[model samples]
Every structure is written in structure tokens, then in C-alpha cells.
Target: MKGIQHQLDLAFGENAVTVSRKAIDAGEQNLVLTANTRGAALKVFDGGATETGASKLFGGNLTASVSASVSNTSKAGTDAIHNTLDTNTKLTDLTDVDGNKLGLTAGNVINISGTQNGNAFSASITVKDNSSVSDIMNAMRNLDAFKGATVALDASNGKFVVKGANGQDKDISNLNFNAQKSSTDTTAVASFNKMFGGFTETQKAQDASSDNSLSMQIGANQGQTLAVDINDMGTKALRIQDVDVSTAKGAQSAISVINNAIESVSAERSKLGAYQNRLEHTINNLGTSSENLTASESRIRDVDMAKEMMEFQKNNILSQAAQAMLAQANQQPQGVLQLLR
Candidate 1:
């Protein structure tokens, strides 16, 4: 219930709608919602998603849902590909199945061709030294087809193995190998086949589970969004929906389940708190910008009454001085007229 309210506030602005849980009876509680404004309306739909704010608030469904869970089905992965060459023996001294040493020298190329992770690729591994199986395994890892796949030696089987990364499904197919003849070694292809041709698949590949996460736009602009992966908080998800607490053992089990539910809820609350803090900071920055812009607008549009009044008084004084000078000149002209008479 708190999750719903937090999502609402995050969607419709803070405090737009308040949701409160109140006890109606001894064992029942009612969820009460009070809208502080008339614009807040939550519309519940039947299908997948809608453009309404309510659809996004509820994670594009009728109810707030948990993240898409990975199917607990058996993990699908690629068959382990390995070579029969003894891991303890060096490539130069490695013996064939006939118990004869290969006597391979440097510059012998082991042509590896396979499709890893659905991409077809081929490469030649130049024998750096007959040192260890890692020379070949490491070289295989550098291939683009095996970019994210694993290539290692299986100690239990003494065979070099390759698998998908993190147990995910890897499409490895059309695997083949050949040895190219070099000037230093004419029998390189025959020696390479005798030592490395025993590669086989120990396991088959399978697919991974699907994800059920929903993407929600929290901000007004593009890319200002987050993926909401709410864990199912209902009794079924908490493992307490069908649990009976009538017996002592049942009650004990219920305690454990409830504790787990509390932890889950606490984790969700922590995420909500972080999101709220971030939104609050964004709102504060926007508010500060609004205040600064308003102050600038006032400075441009508002009049300075004191400054204007001072300019008016100075202009009035200049006009009076000019009138006084004109009056003095007129008096002098009148006196000259009297002298002429």
C-alpha cells in the first residue's frame, strides 16, 4: 500500500494524493485515499497498458506487480567442448592415442573452426610453446565468437572445455578443426589431428528465462525514466498466503516468512526513499531556478520611483532658473526704455 502511494506521489507530484491504512475491525484494515487536488485520478484498466497516468502508476497493469521473474526451469546451456589431449603434457611432447610422441615444434598451426554464441568464426592457434593447455585455451578466449564464453581446462577430466558465460544459452555449432602445414613442419596436420582431434561435447546447450521488468517514465522529458521491478508483496509471494498458524510449528514457520516479508518491504522502502530524495533534489533545483528568473523579471519590469522623482525635481529647478534669468533681462530692457524717455 505504501508502495502504491509512493508511486502515486512520484508520478503526480508530491502530496497530490494521500493513502492511509486504517484499522476497521480487529483483524482488518482499510486503505483510504484522499486527493488533495481534483486533477488526481487513478484509472484501472483490464489489458496491458494505456497512456493514462494511472496505468504507469500501477506499472501498466491493474495491480502493482513484481519484476518479471526468471523461470525456475532448468537452465539451457551449450554442450561443453573439450579436447582429449592430456592437460599435464606439453603440446610438443604430447603423445597420440598410439602412445607415440607428436614431436611437434613451434609455428605449427591448430586451425579451430566453430560457431560460438551463434557467430561463425575460424582461427589458427600458433604454437607459442609446448608449455601447457592454457596456451590453446587462452587463444580460444581471444576469438570474437568466444568473446563472452568460457574456455578452460577441466581438471577432473583432463580435457580443455568451453562453455557459455554465466550458464546462459550459447549457440555453438558446426564445430570443426584442421591443421595447416608449415615450412618448418610437414607432418604438423597429422600430429595436430592425433593430439587434438578427440574434442567432444559433454553437455547440450539450453535457453535462459525471460525478464518481467517494466520501464516507467518518472520525469517529464525523454530518458528521464527508471525500471520498476517491484517484488510481489502479496501472501503468495511472501509464502504466507496459504500458511496456517494454528499449530506451534505453523506459527514458527509463519514468523520466519513474515520476517522475510519485512526484509523485502524494507528493501523496497529503501529504494523508494532514494528515488524520493533524488526527485526532491530535482524539484529544489527547479524551484531555485524559478525564483532566480522571477527576481530578474522584476528587476527588468519594476519602476524605481525614487530615482524618477529625483530626475523630475532636478528638471523643475532648471526651468525655474531659466524663467528668473528671462525676468531679469526684461527688467533691464524696461530700465533702458525709462532712460530713453
Candidate 2:
């Protein structure tokens, strides 16, 4: 949404219209684009095509329910998409979806297999007596499969979520977890399926709305434009929107969520800053090119006074020599007539 608004501001003046997200009900999320004044139909010229502000902001043809406020212009999501796992969970002292603690002891090995971003992933995590919930999350995060994904516990429910690091929907599937006894373990361990298998995808992964993304002209030539994809920056997108700070354990779980959100925002800001720098460099290069072109045009069209003066001097000297020779030839003709007389 910020990205959309930025492009709109570049196309139109800043604050010509206001774009915002509103919740009509618990199940749906929508965007609202309102003109500051009546009869101000917000619009923008993207590349060669002219697009209405609503379509550019929401992507594609919008079936908006218009009112005095211009509410529900587009659907962002029904709710933030995420996969949830129990909170304050440790491998050594495992708790299932229910309140029952399992007989999982130290040295129990949990194996995980999943498809992340359309790639197969497998990893085994060893449980230690001192390992906390964070350890498990770290293990998942460290896996190559979850490189562009975030694994963090929810602050409110102590349940963790796995989501796109950039607050976008990710393709992840067949995430299976099961436990076995380690080489040194002798005691009969509780079934890992009851605990780990209960990990549910609470929300479905929804792709970000690309149709709303407008390609802005950033360079002079054709196709020198940028289409900035607007990623969701909501807490639900980060899987930390429902965090609870009322209890100590909840607060502890919330720590990872808060940190993850902070890190995500920081990374996003860095990316935008880098983009700004690239634009600045492009402007400088364009300016330099314009200056060089002007110099070339002057050389082609402008006259050189010094060279013209030198040519004039050379022509005058040659004309003077020719006249002197003509005068001497006339004298020779007169001398020949006097001899004949």
C-alpha cells in the first residue's frame, strides 16, 4: 500500500488522494482510496496507458462498493496467512495441541520434511534438556528450505507461525514432523506425531495483488520502468499481530515476533533506500549524457570564426599574386609592339 501510494504521489501530487486499508468484518480486509475533494477522480498515467487511481491502487478492474468514503476498493486478504505451532514449547518437555505434556526426553530426535518454495527440504533436530522453543524455531530457520521464510512464535497464543519473510504468501507444503529415540536413549518415548503433527496451517497462503502494481517510468528510454510489488506490512503478515504481552511466557514468545518484525521492517527500509540510490545515480548519468549531447550538437552546427578568418587571408594573398602576374603580362605586350615599330 505504501508502494502504491508512493507511485501515485509521483504520478499525481502528494496527498491528492488518500489510500488506506479497512476491515468491513472479521473475515475480510479491503483498501479504500478517497479523493480529498468531491469530483476529484484520482487517476494516473502509467507508461503509455492511462489508469484510474482505484484500478492502479487495487490492481486490475475493481469491483468496488463505492460510497461517500470510497470504502472497499479492493481485497487485500480475508485475514493474514500463517501456519501456527504451540507456544513456549520445548522438545525435551513437549506439549501437544491439548494441554497434555508428552514423555519426550532429552536426546529425542525430531525429523522434518517439507516442500518450501517448490523445493524439497529435510532436516533432523536433536532435543537437548536445555533446549527451549527458540531452539526449535532456530533449527527450522537455519534450514535451506526456509531461507526466504520466517519462523517465529506468536506473542498472544505462544503458538509460532511460518510465513514469508517479506510478508507475502509462500509456497510451502507437506511439512511433516516425527520423532525417534537417539542412540543413547533407552526409555520408551511418547509419540511425536501427536505434538508435531498438530502443526496446522491456520490461514491459507494468498499471493500479493500484482494487478494493482503500476509500472512507473524511472528512465528515459522505453521499457525503462519499475513495477514495485507492494508487500503486506501488517502484523498478521508477520504472524505477530495477535501477540499477547499480558503473561510472562506470552511475552517471551512475543520477543521473537517483535524482533522478527523489527528485522523485517529494517530490511525493507534498506531495500527502498538502495532503490532510491539507484534512481539518484540514474539521474546523474542522464544529466551527464545530456551535457555531452549538447556539446556534440554545438560542434556540428556552430561556426569556427578563427578558421574562417585564416581561409579569408589565404584567398586574399593568392588573388594579389594573380593580379601582379596579369599586370606584368600587359607590360610585355606593350614592349613587343614598341620593338615592331
Candidate 3:
């Protein structure tokens, strides 16, 4: 409604801003209104005491129904478009119990998968080149994501550079690029570079596409999380031993925990959907009502430019005739002078 009003202000004026604040003033207004309780809606003014100004909403009600008020004539403009178009995120992000993120990679990746011991969690990721060393260090430093995993470089000989100092057996899934940045640019990289649309580099850089990856490992049992192995470049898979639960019930219990967590997340999403629906319905009704009211107002108050133009033209002719008559009047006075002469 704000958006519509804004547009109307831009096109017409703030008198276009429609607000429905139909409240029954407690003592200020009174008139015997026809009992028309149709559709839980009470349109058709009852002339009932001028409504004392729209009824108030109860404590639990969200927003009270009000009539559109053309409060300001200059306040409508295009800036209110955003009010009509709302983008809301209703769901919580998908994360592990400890909130570990598995995100898209910019360039090629060499991943390492592994399991955990008593306190030490280990995994190794392979990088396409030594350029990944800094990236590896950075990921390791970010303990907030992979809370249980401590990352370091394993001894490298010639062809193989090892990661995962704690000895967690992790599989390697490396993302491969076609040769250069233009071949495979990702959003993460583009954001730093500000590629408006897709991954297309404005500047050219050689060897930018060369693959670089960092192997990583996290907790042994950070709860049952489904592992998604990312593989694009030449990479190998690393597997972990199945969790050893002594009894079937123990395993089922873990599964149940995972299920419950998933369900909770789903419930939150459902709530968001409901909220969005309710808002959308309200906005829809408001928009329709505003439009109808605005059209009606234009009919009532707005001067038709075309009609005004015609009126002005007629008045212009009359003025011209009046000027001619005044000249004739002056000639009559001259006649009096002639008689005196």
C-alpha cells in the first residue's frame, strides 16, 4: 500500500496515499446503522456518528482495519515500490549440530575426509598447488566452523603433500577448473571481485585458474551429519569407519536425535511460510482497496486536464471580446469630445 501510494504521489500526489482507518469512535460518533454483518465486513457507511474514527483493535489483533486516508498530497512516489515488494528469509540456515558449513568453492578444491579419536579430530584435504597453503591455514584458524578439527600440513615428499596432522582418514574431493578464471569462476570469488552476474573476470590474469585446495578434517562424532563429498577435479574419496554403537538402541537413539533436529528446522520454516502468507494476503487486500479508492478520488476531486484546457480556451475568447468592447467604449467618449469641439 505504501508503494502504491508512493507511486500515486509521484503520478498524482499524497492525497493518493490510501489508509483504511475505519474505527468507531467510542462516544464521539453515533448513528443507527443498518445491521449488515455480511462477510464479517461492514462497508457502506452507516452515517453512524461519523464512526468516531475507526474502531480500535484488540490487544491480540495484528493490525486494525482502517479506511484509506489521503493524509498528504505530496507524499506519494516511486520510492515506495520496495514496500510492495518484500523479500524475507524465513528458514534457518542448514548447519551441522556444531554449525559447520559446507559451502560452494570458488576455484578447484582438494578435500580430505577423516574420523576422530578420543579428543583429536583429523582429516586431510589436497590442494592442486602450494598456493592453497595460506587458505589451509586460514580454514584451520577458523575453529568456529570445524570446531573439533585442528589442521596442519603432513610431511610431503614429491608428488603428494599430506594434511591432517592428527591422523584422521579423510577422502579427497578436488574441484577442477577448465584452465583459467573464465572457465570456472564462482560467486565467492566474484563477490570479492564484484562480478555482477556470472563468473566473468573483467581483467585477465594468467595461471589464475590453476587448481589449489586445502584438505580438512573435523570431529569424529559431532553427531550424525551426512557427509557430502565434493568432487570435480582429479580427487579421491576418503571413507570413515561406521560409528560403533554397542547396541541397536544406541544407534536408533542417535538417529532419532538427528531426525528431531531436522524436524525442528522444518517447523521453523513452516512458521515462516505462514507469516509470509498472512502478510501477503493483507498486502494484496490493501493494494486492491487503495487502487479502487484512488480511482474513485480521481473521479471526485482531480480536475481533468483536458476539460480544464477547454474551459480556459472559452474564457480566453470571452476576455478578448471584453477588451474589444472596452475599446468601443473609449470611442463613445471620443464622440462626446467631438460634440464639444
Taken over the whole model, the C-alpha lDDT of each candidate is 0.54, 0.57, 0.33
TM-scores across all candidates?
0.32, 0.33, 0.24
Q: Tell me the spans in candidate 3 whose CA falls farther than 4 Å from its real position.
A: 1-249, 300-318, 333-341
On residues 7-82, what C-alpha lDDT tens digit does candidate 1 reach at each position? 7565433454556656667875545555443232443222333322222110112212211112111111112112
Candidate 3 lDDT, tens digit per residue, 1-341? Answer: 46544543332122312323344665333221121111111222442212222121111111122233332121111111111111121111111111222222334332322222322323323323233334544443353323333333222210122233233333322211111132334223222122111222111111111133222222235332222223332111111112224656445433433444456556666765765676566578668888998998888665676688889999999999999999999999899999999
Q: Which window of 10 residues has the lowest lDDT sum in candidate 1? A: 71-80
Ranking by TM-score: 2, 1, 3
Give the C-alpha miss distance for residue 51 in model 2, angstroms: 59
Per-prediction count of colliding residue pairs?
6, 6, 36
Candidate that scores best on TM-score: 2
**Each model's RMSD to truth, in Å?**
24.2, 21.9, 35.3
Candidate 1 regions off by >4 Å? Answer: 1-88, 167-169, 183-188, 198-341
- What are the per-residue Cα lDDT tens digits for candidate 2 across 144-262? 75766667776543445676544455667777666778755534354555445545442224322234343566777876766554567786556554566676755654565577678
- Residue pairs clashing in model 1 are 68-212, 76-206, 77-205, 77-206, 78-205, 79-203
